[model samples]
Target chain A: MTSNAAGAGTISYEQAGVNYDLIDPLKVAAQRAAAATAGHLAGHGFTEVKASRGESAYVVDVGPFYLASIVECLGSKALVADEMGKLTGRSYYAGIAQDTIAMAVNDLITVGATPLVVQAYWAAGGSDWFGDAQRAQALVEGWKKACDTCGVAWGGGETPALAGIVEGGRIDLAASCTGIIQPKERLSVGDRLGAGDAIVLLASSGIHANGLSLARKLVERLPQGYMTPLADGSLYGEALLAPTVLYSPVTEALERAGVRPHYCANVTGHGWRKLLRHPAQLTYRIDALPRVPEVLRFIQQHAQQDDREAYSTLNMGAGFALFVDAADGQKCVDVARGLGIEAVVAGRVEAGPKQLLIEPLGIRFGDDDLQLR
Target chain B: MTSNAAGAGTISYEQAGVNYDLIDPLKVAAQRAAAATAGHLAGHGFTEVKASRGESAYVVDVGPFYLASIVECLGSKALVADEMGKLTGRSYYAGIAQDTIAMAVNDLITVGATPLVVQAYWAAGGSDWFGDAQRAQALVEGWKKACDTCGVAWGGGETPALAGIVEGGRIDLAASCTGIIQPKERLSVGDRLGAGDAIVLLASSGIHANGLSLARKLVERLPQGYMTPLADGSLYGEALLAPTVLYSPVTEALERAGVRPHYCANVTGHGWRKLLRHPAQLTYRIDALPRVPEVLRFIQQHAQQDDREAYSTLNMGAGFALFVDAADGQKCVDVARGLGIEAVVAGRVEAGPKQLLIEPLGIRFGDDDLQLR
Candidate 1:
């Protein structure tokens, strides 16, 4: 219900303690500094993928293959899992681990790379956090399951107990993934995106990994807190704790079908506003929308957000988007279906200003709303 | 001075809220699960080097070359930088960033891999943490400088603001590094380790990214806190915040000289106990010891710790140790000196019990001390 960082006309996310106005500048500065260090790669016989600077992943042009890397953290979602576990007497850490891996691997695959290895970074406030055998076992099992599902080696990790940095009994979960793009032609960063490219959407299970700061904030105002029930009778916190949909397999299926998208967008922190994440100045027009999950509908209703605000701040339904030739849209959807994932041709790109138009919701997001670089 | 987790007969690090007894089993379990997923790499034409599982870095055999990866965090070193910056009117984040980079890159090179790319993970408690342009810019410059120093590309990173998980105004710094090892003979994981190999010690600038939890705790007992001066007249915290040495150059130089060590150990976390980190069961005999840095000497004196506990916990002097042929002992030391890094023929490896014997100090650490796997 709060505005996403990329589209913050309101102060909700700022009130939630994440202010993009202050954070985005630092990102831009880091990008500039990072650009200057590209020359260092050449010494190792690897060239920097110049266009991958602000993309979801950083690509390195190693001979015979391109390597894409990403480092991502699951923001505050574990807090909800902890609270819900206390009330339900069941540990949700398995799902929490899956969500963490999905957050990183999803971003790495955005550059048309196949994830090969994933490393976990789990920092707990105290070592006692792992004394809970069920929780620890669940985390281990989930991490392994996620690696197996994504077809990436569980390439070791670091689990440090950060006493003073993290809050007691709490943890901060993160992961870094390295993927490979072979044959060179598989690389995608929107350079191949055309005006008439069809926009294919892969449905999200729920909130996935973004906007948890606002959702957790909204929980405090509800009388029942996490126990509040939605119209579908699911607990609010449990609904929000749903494991994120891992799209690595979907991308793999498309790769096998040779239906590569010109560009792919992982609908994460920026919500639907991420639809225009590419540097291309094309307009994305969505003629139809997926049914908003009941949990998201409840959040929008309780947060008192209008259609535009809700769509711009949360992944109302779609989680991953792929811009491909109009002829390949249905084929992309069919590939996803083959993997038991729902997908649809949601819209198409047009020759216009850089913006996203959700025609069904009568919502519009201009280029200025989302400035990553 | 407390006992290292690998040799914790005392409860210093435990009192610091990092109880390894509870955390190590979880790590063992995660490693077991990880070992099960090595097959996942075969799908991508990469094979996990089984021996690399419990080592400092994970290695993948990719036919013509091997890729080594490591994930490491700077722990609470940044908290010291934060406090020092507030106390001194100068920001030390550039060094802090370098320390963070060193933590990961140092581990990567232990497998004899030349670092190729490093991705950073900076998780702040709140967005306001980056509002300080000086601190932010210092971090940016430091990261670029460190990447340039290591000759690796500054791959993209993620900066998340986790308000509830991380402490307010604090940040958790971690990084993942991917490196290359060509010719396959360059890989060193103790398989080549043998008796009579000389032990070469690389002098640490100071405490390099380990035992910081206890170091930060000891500050509470000091009346002047971080401002307390050492015998050498340097501020206690500033010395503690000194940048960790980047050992990548030493490894590179040794490689260029065609003098590959049988094994290398980044003396971290476990202190001198890390000297025998290789699983060869050989006794490591140290006849000479490097002069302990003044700051570490001050820590031992103030904390009322004897030589045994101090050496078992803090770096005591040597930051890195390499085991090689007796003929190459002085050559290794000379290589480090050529790069402006002090080194000495500190010890030798013997075909004896699995233990570390500090000859001058009459100290002995049995095999039971350190249990990484």
Candidate 2:
């Protein structure tokens, strides 16, 4: 099956995504807009070009002194939570909080920042979470417990009641995490990654949180318990709902060992667009990956999606990727192992123009998002 | 007219009046949520609670040291702008800058802060507003012009784009304004006004930017070209859209006139909630007030709302309320006249709990919001 045909086949919001043509012009517009006001637009180190008219988004120069990160993911997992509620499942919101923190904490680690405060916003149609104070308090406490486990402070969040916007008692949970970084540098694929650097794969706890929107659509069509082809087949729901693992400690150990990873990118969705945003003249070749769980295989086959599509559509087994010096690679892996997470030699960078070459599998993500633009 | 309706009788998010029971518990829950995180909250000093959990919409505060205050408002006006587009009118987002700035600036004046920056987020469905680039640029420009007129600085903002949850095609505009305030000794309705303190009234510019969700609904029921109707059949959309006058210079004058003026509050609605919040025990009696403008009269009639409901719903013609010594009452009038806005003595304090007593008009508002328990 063609990649686009399997994923993003149906036109949706990105079809309504910001007009890329207006991207450059809006930068120019924002410059003019900022000039007519008080302080000059704060300069952010990440911005490559500052333009003139309208804008897509304003990236605040939060200044590197200390960085606070706020991130949350949206997926059909909330729908699963609804199902669990009907079937009398217990973990409920606690299960969702694990994934929320998993996503937020990972963002902080990727940015070399540690989590500070986590504030969540839960929007549901007409759920009286307040009436059952125990349930409401428990939901928040569960989120706090997850944060405490990750060694981060827990803040608070808003539980908004939107009468019509939400559906089926379905709720969307989001978190804003504040992070701090006495950051020595920023991480992107473009620079540090040179040819021959070793790549390391960090084991993911189940899915490690992402692609719920894609996963939900696939699971809907699959016959229940298709993986075992037996009893009550809610395995897809349980697997897809598995909480993501927090990896702050894993990345922290690598940093403490003075093993600077040449390039690190959170690997999710077997697709290559995000990785492609890295260095323009280096090739990222990943040879080894942790065991692929059968849950993904069952869902992928049932959805009629191919291997390449499933990879980019799910995190597979590896949630994070790291590139290190070939000479110090074992030390880095040892440090990662010390943190209680499996770290294995994945592959090496090669001389090429920003490409991901999957050798053993004879697969190449080369067309739209794979090649360097 | 019920005493607690948040908007005019115009159709609103709640076709029937607000469900205070639902709203009340939400506020208590919000307070719990806010307080849990507030101890860890940094950056600003919490100001007066504007509309509390059981009472109103926002709880506004003033910033210290940074001296800048942020004014945040629910952009109900954006709904009207959207409806304008849905109907024959397209440039409906017009004149919203004043409302954006007005909502914030009004809050700033309460704490003796002068606005410096006005940033807005407009979520335009498929497009970019609730705040994308183009609207941010324009809103900033509009705020700049309005703030420049009031001698306040126009700083920048943060705009975003969201695809789901919010209505797809409508743009939702919300603002966060930052203004500079010097050390003003605790300005909470302090223990100053006791018996016989005169209440003075200042005029509101049109709707003064709140409750447009209902106003738009009422406006839609009218025929085309009805938006700009004026005496002699002249179109006056510009008049209705006029920005609320920035009262920074006048507030500064009132402070300098040795007129610690007991207490003061900006009047967005006819109800004097802020005045009641001041630390004083007196019955505020209104003796004389300027003629109510026709636009308010229309909203009052069109929505089929009477005096008290309409009073708390729309600002009517009075936008600012100040309590002063009867001795300097005329001087207060002279100052507002100097600022080119008409003002007069509306009422006075008496020997009792804070009550809004309309003497000439023969009405008494036993407002629960004025006294913070």
What are the interface RMSDs of all the models? Answer: 0.8, 7.2
Pairs in steric clash, model 1: B6-B369
For candidate 2, write residues A1-373 as lDDT tens digits.
2234235343221232433343334434544555555332221122211211121111222333333333344334555655655555444666776676666566545545545455455654444434545445555656766666555544333454433333424455555454444353533223566888887877776655555545555544444521333123545666666667667777666666776666566654333334444534677787776666556665556555566666655666777777778986788678878877777787887887666666666556643554212
Q: Write the per-residue lDDT of candidate 1 for residues B1-373, one digit (tens) a residue.
A: 4454334333355665578889988999999999999998888777988888888999888777787887898898888888898899899999999999999998998888999889989999889998989999999999999998899888889888888899998999998888888768999888988899999999999988898887887777778999998888999989998899999989988988988888889999879989878777799999999889998888787666788888888899899989888999999999999999999999899999999999999999988988777
DockQ of 2: 0.14
DockQ of 1: 0.81
TM-scores of the candidates in the order shown = 0.95, 0.64
lDDT of 1 by residue, A1-373 (tens): 3454334334354566678878888898898888888998877777988889889999988787887887889989999999998999899999999999999999998999998889989999889898998999999999999988999998889899887899999999999888888768889987999799999999999999888887887876778999999998999999999999999999988988989889999999778999989888899999978778888888787766788778878999999999998999999999998888889899999999999999988899999888778
DockQ of each: 0.81, 0.14
Runs of candidate 1 with Cα error greater than 4 angstroms are A1-11, B1-11
- Candidate 1 is scored at a TM of 0.95
Top candidate, metric lDDT: 1
Question: Candidate 1 docking: what grade?
Answer: high
* TM-scores of chain A in all candidate models: 0.96, 0.77
